[model samples]
Target: MIRKIIHIDMDAFYASVEQLDFPELKGKPIAVGGGGDRGVVAAASYEARKFGVRSAMSGVLARKNCPELIFVKPRFQRYKEISQQIRTIFYEYTDYVEPLSLDEAFLDVTQNKMGNPSATLIAEEIRNKIWNQTQLTASAGISINKFLAKIASDFNKPNGQKTIKPAEILPFLESLEIKKFFGIGKKTADKMYHLGIFTGSDLKSKSQDFLEKHFGRSGLDYYHIVRGIHNSPVRPNRTIKSIGTERTFEENLSSEIFILEKLEYIVEDLSFRLKKQNVAGKTITLKIKYSDFVQQTRSHTVPYYLSDKELLLDIARNLLFQSKLKESVRLIGVSVSNLNSDQKKKPIAVQLRFDF
Candidate 1:
């Protein structure tokens, strides 16, 4: 059956929230994050984006890009409250909702509560309702599957919706740039370019075996998605695979002592996150990035689940000393994986009421 999927994404969620709460911030370039030299941007408003400011950029660089950029500290609790309110609206339409983040989600409305036959109309209604209730704008993509829906959502962004009907799927994929495909990153797209695969049509020309030899397991996914074949469902109860934190330092440090000092703080942050989520993991990983941009990781899996700060710090310290520093380190991170919450759950299949 041809499934009806809708991908909904909020426009500059964190930055927009800031603008909504503070009217004075509206129409002004704003970044939601610390303004300090060592801080990073959590989100950038559309105004700031025009100046090439973006999320994950250093505050210093963001300021350099937009001299008038106003920085506000992030309020995660307030964001979560608003996220919950938006989620409640989603639940009113369909039980099959998969949230990608606090700002974006996918919904399988093939069998909606409203008994709506046209997914396009449903997407329009949802966008209108969201704006009416929250005074926030959303963009939507409606298509036969999640892959196409996700790609479509970005076509007409900010406060618009697009529907890719069955007839348009093939031509749409053929003309699409490899970089615009959902899972293809910049590095992968570059690799594809060197292999003469610049567009979906070029990608389709390659055999599955040839793709697998280069991209390994992801090759099959690439082959299928370019043909509009993605069966991954919208799982409402997605499990948390891991929870961790990391920090990029303002200055590079060559000393192990300084790295250990940084790890202590990271351990504390990771511990707080684990405890808040009521989950623990046996595997702890130490991620190190050198001044020259080379990255490495060292991991140790304990026999039992651990979440204590002291224990995590101890493990991180051991991992740090286990290997010699390649060069002065610019970033240090600690993460917990193999989580207790990582138990596999069966995906909830959609029982289609109609076929497209």
Candidate 2:
């Protein structure tokens, strides 16, 4: 049976929250993050985006692009509180809500409590409820599956909604640019462009064997997804297997001291996040990406849950030096898995419900 999926994404979530809380900041170009050299933008308001500012862009570059842009420190607690409120609204419709992050979620409403046959109307009502409750806006995409729904949500953004009907699915996909496919990234898109696969139609024309030969395992996914065959469910109650953070440096560092310094910051961030979630893990992973983009990972599993930053740093340092550096490193990451779920204040899954 064809499933009805809706992808709801809050437009500039963090920045929008800030604007809602502070009325004076509404029409201005605002960013949510540290406004320092090493800082990265967590969100950019539409005003800031008009100036080419975006999330994940370095604050230094964002400021260069929009000198008048205002940067507000992120308030994750406030964001989470609002996220929970929004999620409560989702549960009222259907418990098949799968949160991707604090700002976006996938809802399976094929058989909803309201018995609403129209997914588009459900999306509209959800958006209206969110705006009414939070004084914020969200964009929604409605389609037969998660992939199409996700792509459609971005079509008319910032308090708008779009629906990709069953009949239009194939045509909509055929005319789609390859870069817009959910799983396709910028680098992959570039490779596809060079390979004469500029659109979904181009991708559909390529044999599965041809795609696999070029993209390995992911090529198989591309082959099916382009043909409008993504069957991945909107799985609710997804468990968190791990928590981690990584950073790519502006310049490659060969000095071990410099690398260690960066590792300290990464460990600090990881520990704070773990503490915030009241979760800890036994396995520590160290991810390193060299200057040429070659990557390596080293993991050390301990008998006890590890949340201590100092200890984490020591373990990460050993993992780093244990592996001989092949070249200067461009990026580093630290993560922990084998999580202690008992410590969580609440279950990770959306509250389950069934339509009788």
- Alpha-carbon RMSD, each predicted model: 4.9, 4.2
Q: Give the range of the ten consecutive residues with the poorest summed lDDT in model 2.
A: 347-356
lDDT of each: 0.88, 0.87
**C-alpha-based local distance difference test score of model 2:** 0.87
Clash count, one per candidate: 0, 1
Candidate with best TM-score: 2
Clashing pairs in 1: none
Scanning candidate 1 in windows of ten residues, the lowest lDDT window is 345-354
Q: Candidate 2 on 305-328: residue-level lDDT in tens?
A: 988778888899999998699999
Query: Model 1: runs farther than 4 Å from truth?
Result: 243-283, 287-318, 325-334, 338-353
